[model samples]
Target: MDRALELAARGPAHGPNPRVGCVILAPATPGIPGRTVLGEGWHRGAGTPHAEVAALADARARGHDTRGATAVVTLEPCHHTGRTGPCTRALLDAGITDVVHALADPGVTSGGGADHLRAHGVHVTAGPRSAAALDLVHTWHHAVTTGRPWITLKTATSLDGRVAASDGTSQWITGPQARAHAHAIRAQVDAIAVTTGTALADDPALTARTPTGTLAPHQPLRVVIGHRDLPADHRLLHDGPPPLHLRTHDVGDVLAALHHHEIRHLLVEGGPALAGALLAADVVDELHAYIAPVLLGDGPPAIPPYGITTLATAPRWHTTTTHRLGDDILLIARRTATHPDPDTEEA
Candidate 1:
């Protein structure tokens, strides 16, 4: 199970598919209680061979007999044919006898894999090392279950929750460590989004850069949300990849378009209005705030008031995690279980 978890962790940082790992163990020989590991493999992304099939192929290449072998996998073997063939069929064809899976596949079309394996007479053990497997595909699960991308609102603010000074001079608000951390977050998302206000004000490239300022090898798609066209010479247009222009103010419309593009995780680096709109639409899945130890009493608010007039009506978050990065503090928060609308707030 630990090997399976490790292989699952090697998957891409961001993509539309879930990360999965698999290990094949030959039956225990004689008095030895432990089985010999015959092969190991992990899924890279969509359109790739599944972990089970990869491991089975590796075992075959090494001249290891797979008959009566146990397949230990992080997630349940998929039973539906997607970009690749069904993993359940692969396991059966490989002559795998027993299966140990961490998490059940939650996908609507690819779920119930454990049942199919049992129907085929394969002994199955579910939920072995489940917590780690679930964390491996946290956002992917949310996207598959909700039919929309998981949105994370990321912001750099002052101690008093100010995003900029009174004059709108917001450069270098956080130290190098905090900025680097933010860039790392950008690298792990399918797309980076901002509003027209930010695009015009900052002219941000929206491309993830390494700590040394070079562009990252795998860049997220850059998107600007609003009804107006950007300036002819906007830097984002000439960056690593051309920016995707979404001419709309409706958060639902923006999310729908991204969903169609198969974006699983979206990182919103805000200007206030767009953040307010996402919050008001109640589509935000997580908040990543980097708060520096400074006060800008007269600057623009980090988030504009969106009908949050009374204390009782203010938004609340749960499971906040705090980390100190240089002179800044990174605060991550997720919506509580009691929060309305697990799926679009039932509008």
Candidate 2:
């Protein structure tokens, strides 16, 4: 299960599909009494073979006997076919007799996989490192459950919590390494969004670039959301694909519109009002903040007032990771769960 989880993380950071991995263990034999690894694979992205299928193919290509093998998968085998055939069918075809998975897929279109496998007489075991597996695809899971893109608000601020100085000169708040890391993050998600005020003022090109300043192969859709028009010569309008100009200040409307366009993961590069609006609406899922060592006393706060007059109403998050980037520290936190998981409850 730990190996499967590690493989799952090798998939794209964020996309329309959830990250998944699979490992095939051969049945006990005379020479190898314990389980021996036959093959291993991880899902790449959309329009590609799923994890189970990939692992099975790997075993087949290596001339390994897959008959009666057990499949260890990070996610439950999907039963419904979309771009490819069902993974459950693939496993059954490969002569897999036993199956173990970390988490059941929550998607309505491609769910109920464990039951299908059991109904077909395959021995099944579940809940091995389930929490770790869920965390692997939590953003995609949240997006699937809520029917909207999951957001991660990225901000660079001083130790005192200010984004820019009083003069509005906000360039280079974080060091070079932190900015490079931020660009790497932008390369993973489907879209990077900001408000019109930010668009007009910063005129950010918003392209995911390499450390050498070259454009990365994967670039996010640059988006500006607000009820204001940007100038024609702005780099955002001409840099990459045409910007997704969402002409509205309504946070719900903005998210719904982005969802309509099939944006599964959204990275918000903010000024203040836009981030605060999302915070007030409680739509933001993750917070990615880069804290610089310097403290600017007379600068704008990274996030302005939202509506937490009392301490109890304040937004709380669970810190997922922290890493040092040059002189800055990147802190990532995620929203606390509001409801219990049915699978966990069942377990």
Candidate 3:
């Protein structure tokens, strides 16, 4: 399973599909304590060959007999055919004797793969190293379970929690290292989002540029919200991928539109007005904040007041990670709990 996890880590970092790994073990040799590993493979992304089929093909190409071999995989072998054929059929065709899977597929279109394999006389064991598999697909699972994209709200602020100086001179708040880290986050998500206020003030290109000022190949879709017209020459309008202008104040509508575009994860990098609205709607899943060691006594807050009347009324977040980027500290947090049902909530 550890090998499977390692292989799964090789999958793409920016996509809606879950990362999955597979290893095929041939019949044990006389002196070997365990079966010999014949092949290994991991799923790259959606519309690609699944892990099981890849591993089976690799083993066959090596002239390894796959009959009665054991297949260890990170995710439950898929049963239905969508972008690719069912993995269960692949395993059966390869004459797999036993199958060990880490996590079950909870997707509406792809669950029950284990049951189908079991009914077909394959020995299927579930939940070995399940935590690792679950971790790899957390964002994808959240996006699939809820009809919304997983939002990661990123803000760079001063030590006093101000986003900018009093006079609105906010360029280069963080150092070069921190800015690079922010661009890395931008590169990982399916889309980078902002509000009308930010579009008018910053005129950001919203492209995931590298340290050398070159654009990354996997540029996220640029998303601008609110009913406002952008200048024709704006970089976001003509720089990289075609920008998505959502002329709506409704957060749900914005997310629904993104979901329809197959955007599983989004990075929200906008002003306090947009951040406050997303927080109030309880739609944000993660918060990524970068705090420089400088103090801005009086300036725009990183996040506007959320109308919390008392301490108990305030939203709670649990720290997931913290680190330093140059002189700035990066903090990642997740809400204690998501609202039971967010579809009925107002934006």
Candidate 4:
């Protein structure tokens, strides 16, 4: 399962297809007790060997024989041909007898990889950490299957769910730890998107800032969504490390453009209206909310006015995980499969 999580972590960055991670487990040697993780491999970048092939190479280099090793991966091995050879064939060539995957591939070109492996005489098991693993690459899977970009709504707010002061003065509401964590999330996405209100009000740069010596460099595309024409002096419009741009209104148009650019993962940062609009459009696939410990009783609300006339019209989502980012609480959610039955009360 850890291997699958690792693969999911590689998503939003791996191009063309979401990256996957693989771990090969073999029997312990004389001095070793039980099974040992003989090798680990991750999709390097575009135009590189797939995860399973890379794992095979790593195992061979480590002097670990794969006569009957078990392969654990985040997604089912690809059965169809692609930039590289079929991962199923690679596992068979490596003499791997068993395979465990978190989830089956959902791509039209690559679905049923598990069934193909089973037919090839490899023991296969699915549904181990499948949901969590799928969450990592949800955007990628959604794009492949539905022809749209994966959208993640990101927000940082006070413990009381305020994003700014009553007068709309919001600058660094969260502590350094929470802010830094937000940057890390930004670095993982293919694009960092913000609304026009946020741009006009906050004038945020929306770029990921890493600590002085972190090896992984952040270079996500900067996107601003709204109808307002941004001034040339806007900080985000200038040439810099990561590319920047302004996307016009019409969520569907913006999504189509993103898909054309091969951007499967998106991070939506906002001042309320933006988030509310995406939620209202029923286009948001995921949510990442960072709640700080402090509160501002008369500050800006976490969500902008959704403009829904009644409670029945409100959008409903499912909470997936809640974790701590320093003193702040992080809440992750996914849009429910269907709009809530109006008669059902929200928990």
Superior by TM-score: candidate 1 or candidate 2? 1
Candidate 1 C-alpha lDDT tens digits along 1-347: 99999999999969878899999999879987888999999998888888999899899889999999999999999999978999999999989999999988988899988999999999999987898898999888888888888999998999999988999898888999999999888888999999888898899988788999987777898989987788878898765667888999987889889988889999999878999999998888899999999988888988998878875556788757988999999999997646545455554
User: What ranking emerges by TM-score with the best candidate at the front?
Assistant: 1, 3, 2, 4
* TM-score (all chains, Cα) for each model: 0.93, 0.89, 0.93, 0.74
Pairs of residues clashing in candidate 2? none
Q: Which ten residues in a row have the lowest lDDT in candidate 4?
A: 238-247
lDDT of 1 at 41: 92
Better of 1 and 3 by lDDT: 1
Residue 40 miss distance in model 1 (angstroms): 0.1
For model 1, what is the alpha-carbon lDDT of residue 91?
A: 96
lDDT (0 to 1) per candidate:
0.89, 0.90, 0.88, 0.78
Estimate, for each residue in 20-123, the C-alpha lDDT of model 4 and write its tens digit: 88889994467767678888887766678877888889999999899889998888899878778889889999999999988789877878788887888989
Q: What's model 3's lDDT at 234?
A: 81
Local error of candidate 3 at residue 320 (angstroms)? 1.7
Backbone clashes (count) for model 2? 0
User: Which pairs of residues have clashing backbones in candidate 1?
Assistant: none
Model 3, span 1-347: residue lDDT tens: 99988999899777878889999998667886977899999998888888888899989988998998999999998888888989989999999989999988888888888999899898999999998898887778788889788999999999999988999988878899899988988888889899978998899998887999888768888999989999888878767667899999888899899988879889999978889989989898999999999988988998998677775567788889998999998999999854333356577
Where does candidate 3 stray beyond 4 Å?
A: 29-32, 337-347
Query: What's the TM for model 2?
Result: 0.89
Worst 10 residues of 3 by lDDT: 337-346
Cα displacement (angstroms), candidate 1, residue 313, comes to: 3.2
258: Cα error in model 1, Å = 1.6
